[model samples]
Target: MTKDHYWPKALSKFWMDNEGKVCRLSSEGDLVRGAPAKFGVVGNHHYIDLEGPWSHSIESSFQAADDRISFVVDALNSLEAKPSNEEMAYMKRFKAGSFDSKSKNDFAESIASLIVRSPGFRHKLTLEQKAFRNEFLPDLPFRDSNDLKVLELRNIQIKYPEMIASLRASGKIIVMFSDSREFIFGEGFLQDIDGPNPLLPCKCFVPLTPGMAIAFVRPSGPYFSMPEVVTIQLTPNEVNLCNEITQIYSRRYIYFRSEQPVISKEFTDNVYYFLDYSKHPWMDGLLAAAVNFEDN
Candidate 1:
């Protein structure tokens, strides 16, 4: 069986430290550093059928999309707060032209790949499939296929192509940078802004590097007329919020480029407490109150 990387190495490589390895903080707060290849990998993660010959079609698509986006990300990595006129012009051109049609499709495919290629997503797929099978096909002969078969149903390239297409068709891509604060990435951090609905997120955020991140905002209501690609520097509080979101939504490990931990132990404790609190019905009222308090 082939080893597949759920997190594309190209993207993960951006988080490398001075020693050329990424720092990973586990949910339990154990910190470790390793090469990009050491994490986000699973054997036959894209494998669809045991009886069928192995194919690289899906992996190839991921590679193609990653290769294209790597250029954009690389440019973002080298970007400065006060860009030269040429650089600014290039960014403007990219906003006006590159983020349309085929390029936009590539961007969407890349984001969708990150979401659906994770172990968390696979597990979700497994549970949903198991539920459906139990409810409607309990007696079917193939209903008891191994977990591998069930999990592979999350191959986004095949099963959820429309998600990529949907991303391409709508939403503005915002590229945010921070000179004062660093950003952290989580294993399953492509989170829905409104809630847990992944298929149609009102907004979503992904931190590409310690200095940069991206968000896809559905263009409607208050967010109408948003540009196709927006590049802006984030406030320190906004940067913290991005890291907090990654921590809350992460399945297990959070990755960063920092040598020392960027997030505090107290913050982690609060995040765990919030996670527990979120399970109760009254958490909504609590959250509303917190938001109202913040507004005041």
Candidate 2:
């Protein structure tokens, strides 16, 4: 359409498909799968746009982090709160570059993405990402360019198997990875079978690499349907083991790719879980609208 061309009225926003690809709902009812949409879950809504089609798409949750320097600007303008001169200056630089031009990288190796992989993108950090790290972590060990340069460094995935093993390593338990899908965290990796029923037919444990875990479940129901997810606090050793596992597996994924645009920070978690059910950090339908990504 030209500048003065009449355009059809339609909704052009983001939504998730059966698989977790960020799809762009075009104005003409066309299903163009795999549009790159940056998402800020939790309580963050600082939209940081750069170049390319990526700049055109953004999704923020209701409870998005209030860390955008712009928020401060709005509040100050609206008489919400006051910042010192230094604070104002920092806010200027922060907004110009991003909420967090130089902040800690708080993602575990199991879930690390552009902030750790792509320098071009990491050079531009998001505001929500900044808040999450500052709130949860005091300092990040791997932020320097030289430290991130160690591309071979594999962040551990999980070390929970040992702890779980110590306490009933073979007990039947529901493994709720997220709010939408419910899979039993079976005791050992058994994903050779991708069943028709992802919620009810999964029978094996998820594969564990560094940062990932290899749990051994003692099946409660040989034919169990959807499982429940439990929150387990891991010990130092267990955490270390998970990272060890994640390191081995992170290598398998070298890029942040979707259907068409191939975005990042969306799929650094379990590759099997994503490929198995199209689950991305930002692609959950309900989550895309409500709640935020898990507190991992």
Candidate 3:
């Protein structure tokens, strides 16, 4: 089979190898081998692996995934995928069967780094609350991945319904994809709600906000980051009590989206992809807060 016939046919999947290193193996899409895409949507052109020294620059991975990175990120920016004309348009561009690999690869660094939710954000000048304020805002004008400004916040919110409701009732959620579990949405705010109750087992009232990096997505295709949460600050001992007591972290790889074509980081954040939100069971309110940002 030729490249055109096979790439659209296979679906890509990611998993961890025994060495604890992240490995991505495809179920199909090898041009030499004729295998069809098992999933409904056409293949993401799924190439781009971010690991090792190159994790800082996924140039090789983009070369490998055929640059599905640029396609998806581009499609996401101007067009909203709907079942009607919009969705069809997205697929047309996605499966256009030809790509300017050279140009796209030149722009690969935009989505090169995955924002992380590591312990560093809390104490360091990087990823700190003040850092977030200095760098990001409710509304960011368009900018390409090359000039992309992004921030990643970890352990953002809880999955429970009551918690989500409490967050929504508050306006202008203040989490900022930063360290505090503060939600300042429409009318009410989670920062005022008090973070997760340390007294309860398995209940993260103030769950650590997922590490989310909010960046500028240039029309030329540098993608931005997304996240949602209202964390309850806990002391190290309290954190240990919660860890010894309940499962708070969202299962990795099982519940997050990636830059694809490139593995950007080691862990997952708490936000849902905008492309996934409409159909996602309980994420409408959260999506609104994140997308509704405007320069004040």
Candidate 4:
């Protein structure tokens, strides 16, 4: 008589028939005669070394394969929903009172397109300019430093008193650009005041690298009740300054508030002017003299 191999052909056929539906494989060797009463779990849990005829049984492997497929699908879906590192970085830059090159370019292009589309809008633009001058210009000191250089002129103007007052009240660090050169400096209040020396030492001047400029202004009172506006402007010269400054002061140490969204053209223009003057101190001095009418 031929010896019967322990292969379970009937169970293998049952698994192949119900491919999609859930099913369990029995640990018994066979059902026709020598099959055991209870089935055992397949794969690593049972430590059953499925081989040859038993390995080919579809019923023996379906459960494990299905579980693995489900896990892979869920993992892929999660990855799709998560934000990438680059996207996060861009969002951070927007929030931290800075504009990336692409954003700046897009903004400039949009403005240019608007101007081209409406030639007659020039009068309205002039009126808006005059209105801004009457309302907001008074608070700010007119650029008067002879050593400062005026790189580009925009129709916007800032109110100085409001800016300083807002800064002091908000308790945020105040960064100032010298009108005469591309040097940027910051100041912050001290935690403890001792009589006469209450105000802390002024922070070191950080040179505004050419082609880049940033200004952060908080208009609302403390508690961050109102959102701050961050303006960033860039030009060829400003870009150079940015490179030089970055080398001196690593970019990681630079911190500017990101909560405020920038709105006004005046703020953007001021940043441009600050960056220009910072690079050329001689031009700043000349600007001051010009304002005083000394050269004339």
- Lowest lDDT block of 10, candidate 4: 185-194
After superposition, which runs of candidate 3 have C-alpha atoms over 4 Å from their true positions? 1-210, 213-278
Candidate 2's C-alpha runs over 4 A off are 1-193, 198-227, 252-296
**Quick one: how many clashes does candidate 3 have?**
48
Order of quality (lDDT) = 1, 4, 2, 3
Candidate 1 has what TM-score? 0.70
lDDT score for residue 119 of model 3:
17
Tens digits of lDDT, candidate 4, 1-296: 22211112222121121222212211121112122211211232212223344422222322332223323222212221111122232222221122234333332222222221121222333445556656887675335421011111121112112222222332122122222223221111011111112132111122221112222222222233222222222233433343333222221111111111112232222221123213344223222222222111
Error of 4 at 199 (Å): 22
lDDT per residue, candidate 3, 47-94, as tens digits?
122324432321233243334533433422322212222222221211
> For each candidate, C-alpha RMSD in Å?
8.1, 23.9, 23.0, 33.1
- Strongest candidate by lDDT: 1
